[model samples]
Target: MSLTKDGPTPPPATARRGFLDVRDLVVHFFTDDGVVNAVDGLSFSVEPGRTLGIVGESGSGKSVTSLSIMGLNRGRGTKISGEIWLEGQELISASTEEIRALRGSKMAMIFQDPLSAMHPFFSIGAQISEAYRVHNDVSKKAARVRTIELLDRVGIPSPNTRVDDYPHQFSGGMRQRAMIAMALSCDPRLLIADEPTTALDVTVQAQILDLLRDLQKEFNSAIVLITHDLGVIAEATDEVLVMYAGRGVEYGPVKELFAAPEHPYTWGLLQSMTRLDRKDQDRLRPVLGSPPSLIHVPSGCPFHPRCPYDAQAAPASREIRPNLIETTPGHQVACHLEPAERQRIFREEVSPGL
Candidate 1:
């Protein structure tokens, strides 16, 4: 269950690569203000039995990307384009019926807030039973038995009794576990967990992460873990995708990215994390400046306005957007800084501080 120190490449491009492949995905919201480009040409792949963490500040399109992949943006004033290939099947152009058929059976999502995601009126057991029945043609009694089994498997105490409790009856951690149970009821090949550990105590968060890793190993499911927590990524994910202004600014293996992040935005995030290893440090640093507006992102790189090196950055950094170019065999970044400058800063300055 240990994550790799080196960034592992998805199966080669010549190969089909993975169970889920997202290519040049663009998602735009037509608000009265203007077109808010929530996700602009983002792309990534998730192999079965591996976890990919998508980290970013609020409104960086991390949630939007997951929603787009889940097809949850369809009726939410969002226009989605680009390819979403799941297990050799093209999902973007698939019919609504097709997507619906696949959603709970082949793919499922564990939303951030379990209280909101679950139905207050129904018992947790009833909800889980319904989910199981949707993709399966089992009798109601059989579905209820399956639900109880799932509750027990996810470590819910007194599964036979607690399964009958409502969402409000469970603690935050328990509710989150219930959601995971419901998501796994169908035995999906892909599972997208959006901030699964948010609002939980650190101890509970660690437990939840361990549970997910164990379940991933059992099911061999490709996981898309969306969160702003670096600790969670460091603990569980095989790969990291750092998003800024609706685009991926840095992507690579979690260990490699942490050891030598190439983007300034990534440097900011590392500096911002509260380090339990550095008890001698007096205070934690935070990324300077607010996140950019999606409606009117910066002219060039969206991070230029807050970048410490902006004044001295190359002229094109202020005029043109940077492409996500690979720096190593598996690591890649989208930044205007020259490779030499990025290396110098990470080695001489940023690495020591973090």
Candidate 2:
């Protein structure tokens, strides 16, 4: 797919290199039960034209981290602290008005559900054009033209007439395409896609992923994809972040992390995937137990309770809460066990086939 030159001028060289940099991000919600730490000291960066996938099980703070970046947690008795830098500008310290200006213009998020993101009252074209008009000083006619162009660019057929139809008039895949068109209306510098293909069929999921890849290449936008699916991360991302119990336990290049995952939680995730691929008679290797409650997390390692290797037999693995150490170049893992021991477990216990 060819690049698009529809939006604002690109940032200068230095600024463009680090498009989105998040550091030590923490988000906590106050509830009657207790304070729930949704995101605890998470950090990552996405350079221009790169995709970073944040993967984990449900309630692992993936969505919370993305929403924190988008400043969507405001006014909810939620406490957030950390640095979210978009081209060196700090998003955490930015005021509501400032973040509002940046959203949908400099950075836009494609929600998991298109139905929730789109307004049922307005036509698809009107919604897409409105996104453009909100950021750019273009006339409605010009915005409408841009909207049609985006619709066609996103692989929607008969966009000229389809643009006039409301959200309910389109099929599930069409709605997702319309959502993508709206997200790209102002040609955002960073795109945060939170499970953008969740509700679609497998064929539609592939189409949406392809569309996102094509659009990212065309616009030169940094993308942060938040999803639980390893297949999606493996296929669509350059780097991966594995979150567990509100903290990042493993992070590195996709290839390195997949080949020799050091974290026990990551090993569990891989084993779970392997079990899914095995025959029905094969015993499924689930992660063992449920993730600990955020309100009252376990001591030492957050994943200790469910960790298969954190026991007497695996004495080395139960030592302490491991810091995220670099096991190899650009590959980091949080585990107490030695590299060789971890490798042995990952190869034999987790994935014997590999």
Please report the candidate that would top TM-score against the real structure: 1
**In model 2, which runs have C-alpha deviations exceeding 4 angstroms?**
1-17, 274-280, 312-320
Q: Residue 4 error for model 1, in Å? A: 21
Per residue, candidate 2 scores C-alpha lDDT tens digits across 159-225 of 9999999999998999999999999999999999999988888799999999999999999999999
Per-prediction TM-score to the true structure, in the order listed? 0.94, 0.91
Clashes of each: 0, 0
* TM-score of structure candidate 2: 0.91
User: lDDT per residue, candidate 1, 35-114, as tens digits?
Assistant: 99998878788899999999999999999898877777787677898778898888878888889898888999998988
**Reference-based lDDT, each prediction:** 0.88, 0.83
Candidate 2: global Cα-lDDT? 0.83
